[model samples]
Target chain A: MMRLITSGAGALLGGLMMLAGVTGPAAAQGTGSATLDAVKTRGQVLCGMSGSVPGFSLPDSQGVMRGLDADTCRAVTAAALGDAAKVKFVATTTQNRFTALQSGEVDMLSRSTTWTLGREGNLGLMFAWVNYYDGTGFLVKKSSGVKAAKEMDGATICVQPGTSTELAINDYYRLNKMKFTPILIQDQAEIQGAFLSGRCDAYSTDASALATFRFSQGPKADELLLLPDIISKEPLGAVVRKGDDKWFDVVRWTFAAMITAEEKGITQANVESFLTSTDPDIRRLLGIEGDMGKALGLDNKWAFNVIKAVGNLGEMWDRNITPMGVPRGINNLWTKGGLQYAPPLR
Target chain B: MADTHADPRMSSARSSPKRSMSFAWSDPAFRAIVWQVLIVGVVVGVIWYLISNTANNLAARRIATGFGFMDRIAGIPIGESMIPYNPAEHTYGRALLIGVLNTLKVAVIGVVLATLLGTVIGIGRLSKNWLVAKITAFYVETIRDIPLLLQLLFWYTLLQGLPSPKQALRIGDAVFLTNRGLKLPLLVWEWQHTMVLATLAVGLVGVFLWSKHAKQRQDATGVRPATWPIGCGLLIALPAIVGIVLGAPLEIELPVLRGFNFQGGLTISPEYFALLLGLVVYTAGYIAEIVRSGIEAVARGQWEAAGALGLRSGMVLRLIVLPQALRVIIPPMTSQYLNLTKNSSLAVAIGFQDIVSIANTTLNQTGQAIEGIAVIMAVYLTISLSISLFMNWYNAHIALVER
Candidate 1:
């Protein structure tokens, strides 16, 4: 107990020192490895986000990032710096996201980036944890008379470049002996605009993103049809520059804590009441026992801070994604027969 | 010339006096050489520092380096390609080559079209009629002032307002212009057409030989034989007769609407068309200014002199003033051409996959940012230098001889 108090006091002093360094250079630093030192010194987590993506990282009416992905960035900041709001969101594109993370432009890319083998094996970046399980889908206009993705032969597709959408469509069509012309654009608004204006026959992206874009259409959503073809499996997650094993483990355990919190029935409001619960799993997860946080070079209360700051993963999804009318199907806890299975916290 | 600052009375003392090999700072030549070497050394040192710093940072980050990824399969699908490409089968190198080709297609066609439009507008700006001059002047002023990117977006938006393929604007059965693109019938080529092409090539060679003969005749006897009538008969009439003899029919494949789009015809997508239109229109505004200044630099007396030689106003402007003006026009025109080519990189914003756009995708996919940037730089450098060399040669060709 004395050790916890001293460490907590030390962290507070560190935070104050960081605040004192506020007069330091405000330049966006994207340096080499040891990104943790930079984030701690700057007292802010530079997180990459696709701010145009709804239910993921879209900006709210107040211009604050409000989405599942944005909340994940907050959770990461809480674990790393003990402050949920101490993250600076840098808007990234499909093309520049990986480079931004690799170049240290952003310490964490929680931008709906898929965990691909190529990215892991080639790019010096690690997919710390899968936040959302998704699949590639096609959205076409209802008047196009196209029923299945199979019937999209000889079609022009408006797909964002530097995404799995392009590759999946190409391989899927080629395997089916179909053909397509891709209209590549970087801006999400423009790409969606192209689809609505009938510039391309179909728009191809993630199913979740397609739903978000359709929901954004308000009344005109009826004109667009979200086809039932999921061409590829996309496990979306945050990425950090590789070779930083400590940072990688910290990011991994941060998501593990949130998902574990959801499984253990710990919402932010109910979490305080359950600090006295006798469950050994609960005590260890909340940092009551065990040396789990010691291995991470963090305080035992890191997981507790994360939940208290941003709630569990389920609460985050409810706040960010439920308004978009997308039900929690595969993103539910493993106990509910979803893919979001967290390894035992102990 | 080097001693221009020396006083005449003090010239004997300063007569660039004895070529001394002293390395002292007092020696002006030695000081000049030292300063130049120091500046160059600093420049080279800074560049080396940048390169080494980048290498160290990239190594520390463990980002992949080198160009070996070029052989990897590039699953990027481009909307348009000059060469046949299969995303699954082709390598990244092939995809980059297609990007280079797409860039060249826009640049070459843009250069030709911009020059024609700019020359016309430039001449119109100098017209005696106030309306023509003001309208031309207005176009140049407004277009040059507005950003090219905004104009591209406006053009893309305007194109999106066009009807869908179902209710497309059609010119009979052979052509359709929809929001998709301009669809036009493609002529089906056969052996007969190839024969005609071969005949046309022979005719072109013959026409060049005839023009050379005409030039020699004019030089010797001052009586040049007419070359155009011969050029017409040999070039046009000969190809027609050959084609007709070989029973070449004008067979064309009209575009038929299939599941999602036209299948048989050539589609000039709105992305490419808008990019082409935007680039030509914007670059022409600058080109028009260059052309106008070039024409104006030709003295009014030169035009009167040609008129005094019994030439009509049109003939005098075309035969004398325009040729002289071209000598002034070619140098600046080359820079504008380079600008247009570089500006083509903006195609990324509008969904046209040029070298920069495709290379960007490749780098992201491969994690070779430095190599990808290097490829783009090398391609642009090669293209720009080629243009510069060609323009330099043309400039020398049209230069006036002092004699």
Candidate 2:
């Protein structure tokens, strides 16, 4: 009996040591691990997103989840798995986003999260690319007659707590030496209530969010106006857990393909025609005559599958966001004098 | 030959040593030890594995893991802080301390208000009047069933739905309520305020000692002391006399409506008011149930017996039932206090700038998740422990002693 107990304890200790040793090296690499390889082999992508942000990741009238970020997920699924619908969307919040990714609950996060250095370094996550260029702005009722943020010296601002927007608003006010009360709310519903019920003289958030909120405010939205003051730059992007270089490449190239396709003037409606065209860039992008996809460990026709599955960037923005009346602005292609530029496929 | 009778066990036991070993292994005591060891071993092993993996992962990602990050200047600006804080100049630790203080402020005030409100409602529920009982029951049932987060949102919305600051509802010459927040009269202190405050404090101590002496005198001499009169004299009259002697140490700083809102007085931010109201109302519901159960736990015969002694219903309740009911009420109420403290963590959700909110910003800014989580958990644990210790002492003192 004593011998058995001793042996059992020894075995348990040995097993633990082995596990520790095996996991240690894998984690140490930080990027490029078996998980990424497994995701590739499975041929399906798992996407994490917020369930309630209109024009970003909300459901459509058909109850199908469709948004600018949701389309990005679809495009990545199409590019990698050859089917846009192969991806699964997992709804998450700001507090749970990183934990879900870290725990392998989701493969990639398409939620509108800012790309911050601390997140990149500490959260064991890798940001692929910026999907939306946003900035902090305030919205208020026109009747209040507050033309700019500076006008309401002691105005109360309603903002979501634990977000970049909260800090940005505070900084903006402090820098301008304007004292204002802050109505901090956690959930989306409360933020709306606080704003609509006139608890706050101003509602501050990302410009895109303000536009979405305005559009969704039903009839009384026309009474509100978004101030033109852009306080801070918020570059929202998709993210994946660190130590997954192969999966990271897949997600990065998927977004880059969308931008490049748009830059080449290729729409989903005309993608098939472009596939047969003789233009070198178009032919290469559509994988008609190139080894680009193979280099990323995917099929040569990855871009073609993506464009066919989900339309190009322009199509996505038009379908999901144009209805909200948010102009393409800096999100447009570089050819259109916007900041969006993709590296050469070659 | 000397121990021939005792040697019988030696001979008999020696016949099945292997059997004895096997039996020992199957014994409940041995089994419990084995199981506990196995469970502990596995859990510890798993934790050790995870820790090592996290360390390796952090190293590989070039992410430093330590509290050293707490010393780094937090560039994020906090909205509301009890203390002066500049994100640009202050360390994350200082910022987190501010958050801790804010959390404590809310918890302490919420606990006191919730207790008072709950005790009243609990008594009301058992009142003879049908209207009072039903209303109390409705309040208890309605608030308890709804989620706290939802109630918080409702209260926040209700506050926001009030008129704008410019059109605030004024209750008197010194009070205003608006979507912005509640404004009340502030005490403008003079140089003599310290003397008045010190006198008030001393008088409070004197009142407490006098009450103890009065109770002892009543027990020995059968004399009924007028506790209320003495309390009023000590608490109010003494303070007033001291204030007069000190030449009226303070003046009221009444808030007056200015350009857009009330000015020159202390203002309770809408966030604070909404959070406090939500917490108090929600916690009071649970406290009411606790209080009701505590009052009910005392035997009906005890109250009847007190009445038999020619005591009125109110006096019987005040003298006999309350002391016994308190023993039952206090232990659970301690847990409620702990719950209030823990629930205050939810203040972060509503942007109340509580400890958790500040810590969250620090964590995000410093990239020190481990340290940030530690600070949050530690603060909560400390608060819980302190409340438990204080309540334990009180419980011991009030506990029934039997021969």
lDDT of 1 by residue, B239-356 (tens): 9999988899898999988777777888898999999999999999999999999999999999889988999988997889978999989999999999999999888778889998
Clashing pairs in 2: A30-A243, A31-A243, A32-A243, A32-A244, A32-A245, A184-B350, B99-B355
Per-residue lDDT of model 2, residues B1-403, tens digit only: 7877567576655553343324377688678888999999999988987788767656654555788877787756666777788765788788888888988899999999999999999989999999999999999999999988777767866777788877879986778888778889999877677777787798889889998999899999999587888888888888788888768745789887764466778888777887899999999999999999999999999988998999998999888988899998999999899988988776755568888777765655555555667688899999899999999999998887768
lDDT (10s digit) by residue, model 2, range A142-248? 98887877786877777765567867777787788777666655567667777888877788888998999999988988899999889999999989877667778
- Model 1: per-residue Cα lDDT over A1-346, one tens digit each: 1221232233233223322332222343332226666778889999989778989997888988889899999998998788898999987777767766765667889988889988887887899999889999999999888889988888899998888777888889989998888999877878888888899989999999999889989999898899999999999998987777777888999999999899899999999987998999999998899988777767788899899989999999999888988889988887887888889988
TM-score of 1: 0.91
Per-prediction DockQ: 0.38, 0.23
Recovered share of real interface contacts in candidate 1 = 0.70
